[model samples]
Target: MSDSNTTHFTNPSTFILLGIPGLETAYAWISIPFCCTYTISVLGNFTILFIVKRETSLHKPMYYFLCMLAITDLVLSTSTLPKTLSIFWFNSREIDFSACLTQMFFIHCFLAIESGIFVAMALDRYVAICHPLRHSTILTNSVVAKIGLAVLLRSGMLTLPFIYIGSRWPYCTTNIIPHTHCEYIAVVRLACGDIRISSYYGLFAVFFVTGLDVFFISVSYTQILRAVFRLPTKDARLKTFGTCGSHLFAILAFYIPALFSFLTQRFGQNVSLHFRILIGNVYLLVPPMLNPIIYGVKTRQIRDRLLQLFSRKWA
Candidate 1:
């Protein structure tokens, strides 16, 4: 293996996150919407956590997975948005190399964890609908705990290489990352060496995490649909479908933007930089905001409990 440091270039100690390239003049104006989105995401995820904690009826296998998902979303959004907001509002974009790496690690790790949680939730739905009698037995507290730990470990293991490899790469080019945060590919592109290995590893990591989770989620839902359609009565089918509506919407919200951004990053080289950045931000922000709303509206138990909680407060 060649020494990564032998490159004839200077590696800067810090990086400048160029939030939304060419839109520097509109940073203040743009921050308003970004702030609103962040605010909503934080509040929404917190509400979901609070409701899950306070409501006894929601203490089930499915809601436990929802709580995990909410926590992941909260962490993922918070990991980047504060720094991004600081850049937009105060022009504080300079980040230490280690800090950038840390942010990048958490951003990708939480995203992977969230994806894993989505798969778990899909599996929960599958077992509930397809194997109702065994759902509780299969997804006990210990089982869910194990699954969460496994997901965290998996995310850490998969993402550690990206950071480890990146930390070793000679970032001798301009330390200006043309996005809101130090994403894996964005930072990797700054290195002044043959980055094909790191690039392919990053691609492999994204595909391994998102692709496999999506595949499993799809399979779970396919089995679920088959089971749902087999219900003897129309009301049974509708009621079973109602239970899954939130998860389906959550699946769509989480995966669509993620896959879009991932594809754009890979294939859309000619795509507008601004559009790519916007979609990346959308992937970061939208699901966290939409998830709680979807669950609050579509999940009947959550909706009734929320109404009851608010009504009691008003009374």
Candidate 2:
């Protein structure tokens, strides 16, 4: 029977993405919003990169981290959005096995790197607000570059194992993934082999990367808050808090939906498939869209630079 099973089942070379299960009829309608979201994300992040690069006044650790973040967001969204739109618009849902794994790697890798950038941004805030005198020395360009390199190396190393594990799995079962993008667990669950190890490693990676980032960000903000409160004047306190407000909003914009999607994917067994998939897509889409907007509105330097650029263009 085992020999017969082996003879009957072979690994699939490609997998079919179902886009959104149970919402097949609305795929076209859904594609409209997704298309708009991707457009906005691309334009906004590129604007950020452009503004930061052109303005020498914006050359600081904070903006350097912002540049890293902009690049990451671009790659992160690009890794999945085009294919997702293709599936929706052209009914092209088949993804080659190697391509699927590559998609999975970039998606997860940049997500982790984004989390790392948030931590670096939080540390920048903590230093700027709490140790204002030492901020420049502590987070110099050299230090920022080192931190960026470390983030890339860490995310790539941690996520590289997913490719190995994903490739090694024998997929004798159906090659239909229910989600639009090739999410790690969604792809792994299709394997006929036991997936406990993959599942456990995934959970560990999430906790290790996101968990530590969240912890450091929390500590940094706590210290920042303390330093802000200790300022003698209300104006001083407000000024310090203003510096961090954008970072706080960007962090919430990212982690909240991310946490919801993670929870629903893992424990919301009763949740509707379409709802979970939509939330997951939103988690990935909204942050890249919002980060630039939040920073543009809240950070005075960026806002001023944007105004100048627009005014010059109009002139």
Q: How far in Å is the alpha carbon of 60 misplaced in model 2?
A: 0.8
Cα lDDT tens digits, model 2, 256-275, are 88888877888898999999
Listing every candidate in turn, what is its Cα RMSD in Å to the true structure after a full C-alpha superposition?
3.4, 2.1
Which pairs of residues collide in candidate 2?
Answer: none
Tens digits of lDDT, candidate 1, 1-315: 345534333446788998999888988888888889889988888887888899987899889988898888888889888999999888899999889889989988998998999899888889988888998899999999999999999999998998898888877636789999887788888888798998788789888988899899999999999999999999999987876776687778888888889788767999999789888888888888888787655677887877888999999
Q: Cα miss at 160, model 1 (Å)?
A: 0.6
Model 2, stretches more than 4 Å misplaced? 1-11
Candidate that scores best on lDDT: 2
